[model samples]
Target: MRLLITNDDGVHAKGIHALCKELEKYHDIIIVAPDDQRSATSHSITIAKPLIVKEVELPDIKSKAYSVSGTPADCVRVATDQIIKDKVDMVVSGINIGYNLGTDILYSGTVSAAVEATLCSVPAIAVSTESSAEDYVYENAAKYIKKVIEVAVSNKLHEDIVLNVNVPPIKDEDIKGIKVCKIGKLQFHHYYKETGKEQENLVYKLEGERVVNHVEETDSYYVDNGYVTVTPLHYDLTNFNILKDVGKWF
Candidate 1:
């Protein structure tokens, strides 16, 4: 299979590198990633600026890698529309440094990249590692991702659904098991503090850490408890249950 891999963490990230190394064993891989970290840039495209693409070489991975001056979604779009052009069999995003779970998916570039691929009618998966430390066990995450990808390819998941996988930071031996779950309702409080006064205007910035999620069955909780969480996500954002009621209100 020909796989097109991308990430929001940029071309030089160890996560993507590890993923490419593991994936290259069984499939032909091509990587197109942001030139710099674009985390939380969800499905954004570079419209005003001219997007640039350049070929790059990594240490051990022998796949054809490209660096893009855009968000994760742009990389997938360009890789499918221009670079590979209908030759791609699958699209895999991330092996991200941090977890993207629950409501956080709205701000995640990792999930957006996979969503973009699914929109193009290709199967995709978004993989993330839940680690508080700056450096994570990317090799283990990559191995697990490779196994999941093999299963996905063999079983052929629904085209409209993308897998959002979050792995714990623990060693492989410490991991409990993988769980297929639904997206749980988890939220973080946003706090701001006044930084300075600029030009007679009060300037404030985000201050305070993310709040601890209270939900028990959430992906966040599973990761916190050393279990890999696999959530199947769809592209449609419609609230079908409220459609008729909303229409009446309008």
Candidate 2:
């Protein structure tokens, strides 16, 4: 399979490099990632400004790689439309530096890249690690991702879905197994702190402290308990059950 790989952690991130090294063994891989970190950029595309793309070489990987001066979604857009000549069989985002579970997916550039691929009518998978540490291990995550990719390639996945995978930061032996779960709702406790004041304008920075609430049998719960969580996600936000009731008012 010809795979287009991307991440929000930039082209030089170890997580992306580890994933490329593992996946390249079986599939032809092309990486188009941000030139700098673009985490939490969501599903935004660079339409107002011009994007800059440059070819880059990473050590120990023979696959073609490019560094994009834009968001994670931009990398996918440029790769599929311009950079890669072959048809992309699959789109895989991340092996991200941090977990994109629950509500975090709403603001995650890692998952957004995969979401963009699904919008383009392609099967996509978003892989993330459950930590923010700089030296988190990715060998186990890479192995798990390879299996997931194989399954996705061999089986017929739902047309309207994309897989969101979160691997815990545990040792290989500590990993219990994989869990196919639902998207959990996690409440993050955050606050805005005043950073500066320029003339009459005030600047504030938003800070997320921690997860205050997490539902059971969710991606977050499973990942926290030492299991890999795979949640099937889609772009449909319509409330079908309430549609008929709301239509009566009209």
Candidate 3:
């Protein structure tokens, strides 16, 4: 299979490299990633200015890799539209350093890249880790990602769905296995702090409280309990169920 691999963690991140190493074994891989970390960038694309992309080499990567001066979604957009010659069988984003569970998906560049692929009518998967602990387990995540990709490709995933996977950062033996789950409505306690002043502009930094409550059968709950959670996502934003109720106001 031919796969386009990308991530928000930049071209040199260990996570992306780990992903390239693993997937390259059975698939022809093409990696197009940001020149620097673009975490929490969502589905943003570069438009105002010309995007700068350059081919680069990695220590142990066997795939063709490129570094782009743009967001994660930009990588996929450019790769699919211009870079690669043949039709890419699938798109895989991440092996992200931290979890993209629940509402985190709304702000995740990793997941957004995969979403961009799905929007382009390609099967995609976004993989993430639940912990930022010293023991960042890429091997374990890679194993599960391989299985997930195989299943997704075999079924030829529908255009409406993109798989969002979050793996617990535990030793392989300790993992509780995989769980097909729902996106939880988890909110982070965060605030914006003014860090600097530049002329008439104010520089603020958004910080999280690093705490959350879990709900059963949701992405957070499954990942918190050591299971790899897979949640199918789509681009539709309309709340169709409430259309009739809200229509009464008109």
- For candidate 1, the per-residue lDDT at 122 reads 87
* Candidates' C-alpha lDDT: 0.87, 0.88, 0.88
Query: Lowest summed-lDDT stretch of 10 residues in model 1?
Result: 130-139
Which of candidates 1 and 3 reaches a greater lDDT?
3
The parts of candidate 1 lying over 4 Å away from their true place are: 132-136
Q: Residue by residue across 55-157, what tens digits does model 1's lDDT show?
A: 9999988999999999999999889999996578889999898878778788899999999999988889999986444444788888888888877878887
TM-score for every candidate vs. truth? 0.94, 0.94, 0.94
Order of all candidates by lDDT, from best down to worst? 3, 2, 1
Model 2 regions lying over 4 Å from their true place: 132-136
Error of 1 at 140 (Å): 0.8
Global lDDT for candidate 3?
A: 0.88
Per-residue lDDT for 1-250 in model 3, tens only?
8999999989998888878888899889999999999998999999998899999999988788999999999999999989998998889998899888888689999999999998888879999985454434987788889999888878878866799999888888888888998998754768899999999999999988656677889998888898989999988889999999999989
Model 3 ranges off by over 4 Å: 131-136, 194-203
2 or 3, greater by TM-score: 2
